[model samples]
Structure formats: C-alpha cells, structure tokens
Target: MARRTGLPAVEVLDACESTNDEALRRARAGAPHGAAVAAVRQTLGRGRRGHVWVSPPGGLYLSVVLRPGVARECLRAVPVAAGLGALDACRALGAKAPRLKWPNDIVVLGPDGVRKLGGILVELCLGQRSAGAAGDAAVCGIGVNLTRPRGDGIRPKAVRDGMPAPLPAAYLDECGAPAAAGDYAAAATLFRDAIVRRVDAWAAGLWKDASAAPLAPVLEEYRSSLLGLGGTVLAVTPEGTVVGQGTFLSVDGTGRAVLALAGGGTLSLAPEQASLRPLAR
Candidate 1:
C-alpha cells in the first residue's frame, strides 16, 4: 500500500521480535518516513509500560515507521492521532460512535458499559544524533480484535460487540465498509490516513490548529460513544492511583488528557500508563 502511495513497504512472516522493533531497526538503517512493516504473528508483541501485547492468529498486527521533525514534547500526539484513526475506521464500518479514552485506547459502549475495541503503541527509537538534531524516528504498532479467540483470557468488563456492529451502520450511513477480511484491515487504513494527515499538517508547521482541531470532531463522536465521561472515576497510574470526580475534557495537542479534578485541580495525564474506571460515589 505504501509503495502505491510512493512510500516504501516491508513485510515479514512469523517474526520472533515485535513489528515495531523491526521497523525501528529499519528506520535506523535509513528507512525513510512512511515505511510500513507488517507481521503475520508477533512473538513478543508489546503494550504500554512494556506489557505483553497478546497476539493470536486472526488479528491484525503491523507497524509504521515515521520520522516527524518535532520537539520531543509534541511526540505524544501520535497516539492521539492513532486513536482518531481507529475511531474513524470504526465509524466508517458503522460504529457510528466510538470514543477514544485517553492515551491510545479505543472504547465503545454496549448494553453492559464501555468496552475496549482496540489499542495502539508508539515506540520512539533514539538514533545517533545530537539532542537538537532531527533524525529521530518512531515506529507505531497497531493491533485490532478481528476474530475473538475461543480460550483467550477475557476481562470481566471487556465487551465484544462483534464485527457486524459497524457493517450495518456503514450500509445505512456510507453505503459500504472498506473491503477487508475484518475490522483490522479497515482500522489499519484509518490509522495510516490519520498518521499521514497529522504528520503532513505538523510538517507544514500547523501545530496549534492541528492540535486543537481534532478535539471538536473527536469529542462530538466520543460524546455518543463514551459510556462515562463526566463522573467520579479512578485514575490508575504506575506511580499509584488517584480517585477523583471529573469530566473527560479533551485530548490535548501532546495527547495528554486534560482532566478536570473534583476538588479544584486540573490534571494533564499521559494516558499510556493510566486507566480510567468509573468510581462509585
């Protein structure tokens, strides 16, 4: 796909390491931006905080190599753009409504409550360059649930809305979903487009507007998909955890969540290590 777009593409089968790792390796070896690497199965898939990204067959796992010349502080926005991509893909498929919970988790609500639909991980590969150099690159890994496994571990709160959820809505809304074996393919396309647009916008130095522009459309879509936003919730982090009553304000330019705390404090959280769950007040 990247080749057709004038970008490079690479594919691997049964990779022992993660796709992101391989992409990073290639990037360090002078792979240009927009290069993509896909794997059939990853033995060491990873999630936030180095957690294992469980990968079984029937799922989509791939990574994209990007070299965006921006300050390190602004790098956090990649995941936000990724989440938007996923949400757009879901919307295209008929999700109609999908909310991005801070960081990179895609959340959808069913009758039960909020359920995770997919996730993204952005890994920054440090290169041999000066602190102020512009040679650093990042490899973004995306995983989506296509066909639910039979015996995989299931979180009690996790909900699977099935692939049909988006198709019906797509038929009614856009006439048809993008052709693919499952939602994973559709999601990959969405992520790719979002990344391209965001990176191009950033490259053109349209930072402020690009950062704030996505909030409105994303929030509008999130409002309908999110099960809980303005409510008491527990914010879990690696350092510890905090219980607070607040509303999910909006995802900032750096991808940090601007959360309004209950007492009076406003917190900007890097959602990578944080989990938000509703608290019973």
Candidate 2:
C-alpha cells in the first residue's frame, strides 16, 4: 500500500501507531531504498527514548527506510547527518534556522524562548539485511510541529526562583519564510525529500570511505547549528534523573556529547545513554 510521490514511493496513512513502525515493516518486506511512510495521525508517535510524540494534526510524521550497508561500527554517524538534513530542509521551508540538539532535536527560538520544533528518532534494522545484502539499513523517523499557535511542545522547564517551567517547543510556521507561505503539505514534502536525499548521501560516506563518510561538510553544518556551546546543559540518563550538568561542548566524532561537567571534569556520553538538555536562562 505505497503511493507514488515526486520524491519516492511513500505510504500515506490516515493514522498509525508510529511511522517508524511502518517503516520497519516495509524494511522487513524488503522495501527498496527511499521507501517512506507518512502518517497524517500517529496514535503512538514517540521520540529519543520512549517519550510519546504528540502527533496532532498539522505535524509531519514521516519515516524513511534507508539501506546504507555501512559496517555496524560506523552506523552512529547517520543520525548526525540526518539532523543536518532536517535542519537544512526546515530552514528552507521557513523554520527560522533551528539548532540541532545532539543526537536529534530540531529547536527554534520562539516568543516563549528556545523550544523544540521537531525531533528525530533513527533506528537500525539489522533483520532487514538479506543473506546476500550489501549492508545495514535504518529508518529515519522525523516529526515536526507546524503552525503551533498554542503554548509549548514539551513540559515547561523550571526557571530559577520557584517559577513554573516554561514550555519547551517552537513551531516552524513562525519562520515566516516566503517559500513556506504557511503551507503544511508543501513543507512536509520538501522536508521528506531533503531527509531521504541526505540519508543516501551519508550512507555512501559512512560505508564507502571510513575517513569521509558523513563528510566534513555535513558535520560542519551540523556543528555550526548545535545548541548551547559553552552554556549550561543538564544531562538526564535513561535512569530518569539528572546524571550530569555541565557546559555544553562539541559532539565528538562518535556523535557523543562532550561536556565540561559541572563538578569539574570533561565527560563524553553517548546520546542513547543520556539526554542532554540546554537549560533555558
């Protein structure tokens, strides 16, 4: 049940548990590269760990199946490249040039302050590789909130002095770019294409040449847009409590967060092991 789109073969669904799930299903069925699933409504959209993604109308929920065939070791770089692609597409479609939070969150400056406009959840599908297949494949799950006139996207962050935490979300429509023209469908299409194109580009980089896969060019762009360099950041581990607090530093080659810890030392933690959040104010 895939439909033809200008960019690739995409399955359009009215509702789904998560587009990522659908992409995984496609991958198992030996879906071709660039095959995608786009859901108008997702009943169980989630991000990063298992944080539920509120898939309201007007948000773009898409998952693209990619067969990069890179060795298991270098697979980590794909998310970084995907984030850069999402940022590029967002800016092009008038998303105020959002910053990419490590691992994968697309954030923008908003009236409420800096907030998450979108997020990415990349998953490796090892089972998809047939016995004679070239390499590993993954699903790049991306979700963007469009035209949110309401409060914030995530829970309010607590400011100093007992004030309630402010909402932590920014919307893309706020960018007001000429191309955006406040069109949701057009933006979705452009973003989907950009992300898939990047996946293809990075897969080659990750597999063909260890030195240049996910090239310097893409890394530089992603680095430039990173949020909270030299600013205080709070790191929360899967254990669900703040594990480390520190000055945000650069992402290491392995895509781990290198932070100058609040106590005293510099620590590099994998994105999966921890969720690093830049403190607002």
Candidate 3:
C-alpha cells in the first residue's frame, strides 16, 4: 500500500511467528528503513515479560522496521509515540476516542469501565553493518481487535470490552461496520504518519513541538483516561513487581511516567506491566 502511494510498501504476511520478530529479522538482514511487515495472525505473539498475546484471527497484527540515526537515549520515547499513533488510528476508525494507558496499552470505555483495545511491543536488535560498524535496529509490533474474540481465559472485563460484534465475513458486507476496512486503513495511515513525523522531530530535537508538549499533556491525557488512577495496583517490571497505591502524577519530558508510591518512594516507570485492582472501599 505504501509503495503504491510512493511510500515504502508494507510487507503483508498471512501468518507469522510474530510480526515484530519478522521485522527484526528483516532489519538485521539490512532491510531498508521504513519497511513494514503485517500478519493476519501471529502464531507466537508475545507481550511484555514473555506473556502470550491472545492473538487469533480477526485482528490486525503488524510491525514496522526502523533503522534510526538518532541518539540511542532518545529511543525510549518510541513506545509512547507508538501509543499515541495507535490512539490516533482508532479515532480515525470512529471508535470512541481511545485513551492510552501509560507505557503502551490502548483503552476504551465500556459499560463497566475502561478496558484494553490494543497493545504494542518493541524489540531492539544489536548488530554490525557491512563495514563491521556497530549499529542497532528496532521493530515495533502492534495488535488491534477488529472483530469478536475467540479465546478463553482472558480477563473478563478485557474480553468484554475488547471484542467487537461479528458480522458477515465478506468485505462488501463489512463496509458499513463501525470497524470497517476503510477505518482500519485510515487508522493505519494515521499511525504511520505520526511515527514518521515524530521520528523526524526527535531526530531534530524538536519532539516537544511535534508532540505539542514537553510531556505534561501526554501524562494528563493518559491519567485522565486511566482505569485505576489513585488506586492500589501492581506495577510490574522485568526486575520485579512493585505493589503500591498509584497516584498518576505526570510523564517527564522523555515520556517516563512518574508514580507516587504509598510507602514513600516515588517510582518513575517506563513500565512493562500495569494491572489495576480495586482497593477496599
């Protein structure tokens, strides 16, 4: 699609080990920058901490390959930018404006409360160029729900809010649905454009202008849409899980979320896990 539009074409896969994994392989093999890969289904979809992503049919699974020339330190913002991109994509689809949970989950409001809509996973690869010059590449994978889910053992609230009603399988039959192909295409375009724009801005040290704030507004937006702000929850990281009362404070200029813990230490997170549970009320 991108090639036809004079942009790089996104490689489409019917099924794959993982879109992110495939993208990383291609990047390591020296695929051109801006290349993308997408899969209809992922056989080994992974989430943060090796958790399996309940990937099945009727979802959008994709990845983008990036070989950026920016400083390594600045790469931390990629997930945040991708989250915002996903939110923008969903908005173009006419879904209720989706809210981003800190780090990388997209949430939507349902009868119960806010629930997940989609997620992103980023993987970085370290290697050397042809001249043996050290370099790095990253693959960003995304998964979005397009129709009713078919898995069991999912979070009840997440399953309920994330699934869409099934309709006729034909494209012609789906043109009128809320999450139609047109909407998906629009959302994908928005996401791609946002990534390109942000990458350019970050490279130029103008990310604040491109993002429209140093980071406060992004935090405010995320907090306003959070499902369990000011509640007790577990903030999980690769190191370990920290149980705390989370006060959604703000994100720093680099997109790190600042959380105030109940026992007195302030936790700044670019988290890998965020689960909400109600406090004794």
Reference-based TM-score of each model: 0.74, 0.83, 0.73
Q: Candidate 2 clashing pairs?
A: 69-135, 69-136, 157-165, 205-213, 206-213
Task: List RMSD in Å for every model shown.
Answer: 6.4, 4.4, 6.4
Candidate 1 local lDDT, 30-133, one digit each (tens): 78777767665677887677766666664557787777766555565556555566566656566545666555666554455655656678888766657532
Instruction: Tell me the lDDT of model 3 at 116.
Output: 59
lDDT of 3 by residue, 159-230 (tens): 321123111111111222364344444445455655554444444543334444334334445456555466
* Model 3 bad stretches (over 4 Å): 1-5, 127-134, 151-177, 181-190, 206-234, 237-242, 263-265, 272-281
User: Scored by CA lDDT, what does every candidate get?
Assistant: 0.57, 0.70, 0.58
Give the true-structure RMSD of model 3: 6.4
lDDT of 2 by residue, 144-228 (tens): 7775534444323431111123236665666655444255455666766777677667776555566763334366666788887
Best by TM-score: 2
Model 1 error, position 9 (Å): 3.0
Better of 2 and 3 by lDDT: 2
Error of 3 at 63 (Å): 0.4
